[model samples]
Target: MFFTRKKDIVGIDIGSSSIKLIQLKSQKGTYQLQNVGLVPLPAEAIVDNTLMDSASVVEGVKTLIDSLKITAKEAACSISGNSVIIRKISLPVMPTEELEEQIHWEAEQYIPFDINDVNIDFQIIAPDDIDSSKMNVLLVASKKDIINDYLAVFTEAGLKLTVVDVDSFAVQNAFELNYNPDPDEVIALVNIGASVMNMNIVKDGISLFTRDVQLGGSLYNEEIQKHFGVNNEEAERIKISESAADSDRLKDILARANDTLAIEMRRSLDFYNSTAGEGKIGKVYLSGGGAKSAMLPETVSQKLGIPAEILNPFSKVRFDEKEFDPDYLKEIGPLVTVAMGLATRRLGDK
Candidate 1:
């Protein structure tokens, strides 16, 4: 699946809170956004990256496609969270064919799941400069049961699944397309979804490290609900409404939640620095639904001591101002990065 090519495929991101889909048409080397749609899922439709309500997800995807009027049946979707494992390991340098044959054996030592229960794939990265005999490889494995659940949802929704990608890599693709970071700069792309935050560290447009943290927008909602003694729906409404009567209280609650989020992010950054060596992350790009949380960017910047800002996935994509509201797109841009990245794929992309 990693090596196959896909074409005319829409990127469908089945998030815990919403189902987002984006279709892009490549013009020259740049992409033009042809269609975009988002449909919120019923609570608990997808919990912890597991499909708890397949019918709800299927219906959500169908609604998004119908609302967007998207005709493309082929789609690229992504998965993340505890069910997926991505590891960068060093192994003896060898031919591509040999590596392909031996990757399963190498993966056994790193992946905690039984070998037969997981689908494994690997990409050979550049060899180590200091050790001529060793090479770096990126190994991706996901539980077959989880993969099957996604496949079933797509199938039931009447969309052909072209690619199953990890959330971190998908976000990285979107960031590279829009920002085109410098080769020497190490950038951290953090996607804060409903229940997960995927952090991908990239240098020169190549992903060097990736990690998923179990914290996101839901925490803010929980905090707000607890603080205000309101239901989740009411809490979310107050959190998003700037003119709500309890706005000040909501702000304080959100700030505290953001503080906890920042602490977790800082821990992840420290872990990355400790493992990846001395280079500092030049910039931090925040994405996903959690990016909209109040004071999140400032909190992250202050804690990590690195410039942090919300990532606009549409920054480089071509789209008509008349067809879409520029302000609305900008506001939700972070949440669409993974879908936009998935949309960049063609029928035969390597």
Candidate 2:
């Protein structure tokens, strides 16, 4: 049983284009969406997932809370992009004390950064039944500066940071919570953000392949800006606009975006397939703002032989309709997978 742990907290996803917040109250295996809101980022609040201008992020977060009427003090957030690294390694099956000692020596082969500059943590997966002598471990590392910057935003907004997670794990958390796919199945979770696309492949609930691509929704806007000679703001408006006047413009932008994303998707899958050994990816789950593009799933399906579909983090979870707009929630559901996963983090789980 995956995602057995439950908790009451807010899931805050800070992306390059916007900040999305969600708070859910669990009751009898169902989730109640107590609050949901989004705050648009300033022109330079985040660049490539790094907090470039703290003041802008803080201001936007503060305004989002006020406008959304969110009273929850504790929230969960996640980080992605260049500063994060994930690796899978094997270690002898041993007691916790011995395992810690072995991890340091093991780090020499995995971590590229110096031990002093990075914060390291690991979660033990199931013991290797075939080998019986080894255990699977998932290692995660993020630069201290990146984590401190995120904490600073919460501090300025007067929100408590109850948990911090990387985007790949967060997406995995959301998947476990909602889908609960078979642990033995190799699954791919792809998060397409404004400026970065992240793909994480997991087998038996442990991460095996991880990578980040430098193409995302922003490229669509840039293409629109160049093709139509429109300002950034105007290009963004047309990208998601429902106005009849912009229908043709939307189709054109998405066509080009799909083509570009398909190229990157092929490269990622090829890299994973070449190194995955016996672990073959069975399906692709798409999330993030760019994933909402109607053509993205189909495009990816054509480029990669695996079945592709949009991932809704709340599909299986029930939420109170009185406190939330079901339609609105569904509209933005794909983008909240990371935030929802982070918020579902229970105390003492790590």
Candidate 3:
């Protein structure tokens, strides 16, 4: 929303647990993966979407770029959590040139923070009803401090950050690129990161309801650590069944965590239903690292009474079989969905 993007830009996801980068080349409208990499960060670097250790993030980005040999200096990154806000609002029909000034004034009522503290962007979603008085707009705002922090890190890491987008929209972009949802179908895109889960409900390819739930994979690791008396790294290994423990007790712990995850997702779905008055979600697409949990899809499906599937962000993307293994891509599909979406962003797309 701030800068004009170049023709070639890398998509980078700076998350609580790691930094991910994906660069793609487009030819005749089809995206071909050029480079992809992930670098794990110390848990102290970020917590609950807050940057706790700036140096670690800076080094992580540098390392990811170096390891992947990504030459693209201009990149797109995303932000989420409580510091960011998204709302679909209606305003009296007005000229395009006037909407920007009007939005800053009208946004005061909807935004909780001081108006000057945030950087805002809006998109006209419903331009129909020229005869009517109002038009629908999707408003997005991010705390200026947070945005500055991101810009600083990317700069420090030797890259130019061109686009700063919200996490849910990036996931939505990825979903549309990979799959075409039915026009009448309501679908939920749930992206579970280390510390937050982004839930965006969409219909006809437009976001109708979005929420960031503060429950994610890190909580599962914490539970495993507390229950098994292990540190975080070991707990992650045990959580994924890499390091052995009492199998029965491990199942019990994971079962409880899965239940909690489904419950949090259910609460969001219920809220979306009540406020939006939308019909039930016909299907759900789960992405991000937390989607790797074995029982997650079943748990979410059973709780939400909706069919759930792991989203394949590469369904339509092309890549060399040797450079990217099919089995590996299948396994990491959920993990890279957001970055894949960000990678598809163009020079001046809405």
| Candidate with maximal lDDT | 3
Q: What is candidate 3's local distance difference test score?
A: 0.87
How accurate locally, in lDDT, is each candidate? Answer: 0.86, 0.79, 0.87
lDDT of 1 at 7: 63
Candidate 1, which segments miss by more than 4 Å at Cα? 1-6, 347-350
lDDT of 1 by residue, 65-92 (tens): 8888888889898999998899988999
Alpha-carbon deviation at 181 in model 3, angstroms: 0.9
Tens-digit per-residue lDDT, 1-350, candidate 3: 54443487899999888888889998788899898878899977987677889999999999988888777888898989998988988888888679977889988898999999999888888754554678888889888998899999999999988888888999999999889888889999999998999999999988899999888888789988888899999998887763454887788888888889989999999888887755778999999999998699999999999899999988999999989988988877788888888888766777
User: Residue-wise lDDT of candidate 2 within 1-350, one digit each (tens)?
Assistant: 01122456678889988888877776777675666778888877788778888888898789878988888787778887788877777788888778767666776678788877777777787687679999878777778788888888998899877677888888888888778777678898999888889898877777788888878888878877887778989878777772325578767767878978978888888888897674788899999898887678988888888899998888877766776678988888887777788767764456
lDDT for model 1 comes to 0.86
- lDDT leaderboard ranking: 3, 1, 2
For model 2, the stretches where C-alpha displacement exceeds 4 angstroms are 1-7, 128-131, 242-253
Error of 1 at 19 (Å): 0.4
Error of 3 at 243 (Å): 5.2
Judged by whole-model lDDT over C-alpha atoms, candidate 2 comes out at 0.79
What TM-score against the true fold does each predicted structure earn? 0.96, 0.91, 0.96
